[model samples]
Target: MKTILFKSKLIRLFIAFLIFASCSKDDESSTVDIPTVNYTATNFDATFFQTGNSTAPTIDWNGDQGTFSLSAPLAGLNIDSINGILSWDKTLPIGIHNLQVIITNSAGQTVKNITLSNPLQGVFTGFIINGNSEHLEMEFFSDGTIIVKLEDSGSPPTAYGTWTKNNTTIIANLTNPENGVQASFSGTLTIDTTAKYTGNLYSNPNLTDPLGVFEVVLH
Candidate 1:
């Protein structure tokens, strides 16, 4: 009789254990509530500047990461759109000036602006070249134009070309129809207003090293 009672108690304990396991499994499989993600906006401006009303610059937000606006501005100024760039169409005064811009996107938002000034005016001298000494000098005008004459052999090159400056790079494209060929010289130009320059000239786009790096002082 005792053995039979012990077997019946064991069976009841197994059934109770199975019920508890089922309840724990149900709890593990239960669904959970999740929170929603918030939306935001932003803008991208690697370089920002303002020259005032005299010089109106074209700013490219490139759709600005998303939707946004420009908050900072000169006193008594307005923007064309809230989520894009603002330019000064009127001529700006000749001096350093600050500009402000704001932008936003689906993740967050941002405000940015920069101060810019006109390029420093440089004094220039007439052109000169000496190949024997490996020296070349040319005058660069503030109008973004240049007259460069360089030589390779013991004599100076009679060749002349025009050049222009964009940022720190200078491009000189010249064609010698008499020789039935065209060549381009490009490199970086270090310049200051007092007429000092450090020029690094390259023969091709794949510039291994500057063929000619020299200092030029304008008189």
Candidate 2:
């Protein structure tokens, strides 16, 4: 009887050990490894133009195999799930847009924020006619800052200014750096075949008695 009891105890111990080992293996197999997701934009700051129809940018993605989708329904924009790419329609509004892209895999999901900007921001070159025609360079920033410089043989002076747009109408106020004299400009901006601005410059703050006419096209 003692030998039989001893064998029965040994069997119970072996059974318990097997049960514990099996539970450990199951727990290890159930764990999921999270994935890392990232992407690169072809355009700096992911900026795009609304000049033509069906414009898209190649966005290189790096990560585990996953599905791509937009966090929200972005108007005038679409994305491909198989390969992450962003395409824009010409109907995209002219402004700053905050967008989010979601990537999902069996491990989990990650969301990335992207900013798209479409602004009348560039260097414009043309001529300003006062008494004589002089070449001028005007730069418009998205933050409403304007830099005006006259191109000449010597180091021409630069004028710092602020500009505002109301529909197609544009108003700019500039102060000469060399002298403290202030000037104002009012114009109509056209963005059709090209970005062109035609305006009149004034020497006075009130914008009375036009100084000259100017035309500049954005590159």
Candidate 3:
């Protein structure tokens, strides 16, 4: 009877050990660890102008993943999905434009607002004569009004005129208050940091000045 009781007690201990081991294995298998993810972005703002071979500026960004999108469609610009690259192959209208860019991932998302300025219609200062390095200022407004000023030695010391632009050309009717003479300038304008307009000058409506070569360089 003593021997049978000892064997029964040993069997119970073995069963309990097996149950505990099985439970330990199940708990270890069910346990899982997850990693943390972070998403971030940088902002941007810039100025540009319409040109013959204009390229759009890009926004610098980081921690981007998944999909990328723009708030509105630009006429001649596009954004890359995998990479944040703003592309511009054509010219845009002269004005201030606003846009928003969004980057999304499984972790989170980021948004950035962009302001772009096209300063094609702005005031520029330079020289009006090709060979003469004199101070001349020109203003091109958005309302189709243009003003040109030349600094000369006189009572006012300044000669002013009004002009208009058609496409890439400018036609100006200038007035000399000191000499009481009116002249006109017709030229093709090249817009840049150092903008220029080169063509002919007309002292009279029917005749062009033989020595007049209207060339203006931006300051």
> Judged by TM-score, which candidate is best?
2
RMSD (Cα, Å) for all candidates, in order, is 17.1, 8.2, 10.8
Q: Among all windows of ten consecutive residues in candidate 1, which has the lowest summed lDDT?
A: 39-48
lDDT of 1 at 147: 53
Full ranking by lDDT = 2, 3, 1
Assess candidate 2 and give its lDDT: 0.73
| TM-score, structure 2 vs. true | 0.52
Predicted candidate 3 versus true structure: per-residue lDDT over 1-219, tens digit per residue: 999999999999999999999999987765533222222423332333433322333433333236667878976566777655655532454445676767666545667666555444566665556456566666665554556676665322433566665666677776667777777778787644445667776776443763366566544
- Write the residue-wise lDDT of candidate 1 on 1-219 in tens digits: 999999999999999999999999887665332212121322211111232222223343333234434454453234545324344422222235465555454434555554534332333333222232455646554444545555545654433455655565656655443453344455444322333455445554444444545555555
Between the candidate structures 1 and 2, which one is better when assessed by lDDT? 2
lDDT of 1 at 26: 84
TM-scores for all predictions: 0.33, 0.52, 0.41
The local lDDT score (0 to 100) that residue 71 gets in candidate 1 is 56
- lDDT of all predictions: 0.45, 0.73, 0.58
Candidate 2 residue 93 C-alpha distance from true site, Å? 6.1
Please rank every candidate by TM-score, starting with the best. 2, 3, 1
**Which stretch of 10 consecutive residues in model 3 shows the poorest summed lDDT?**
34-43
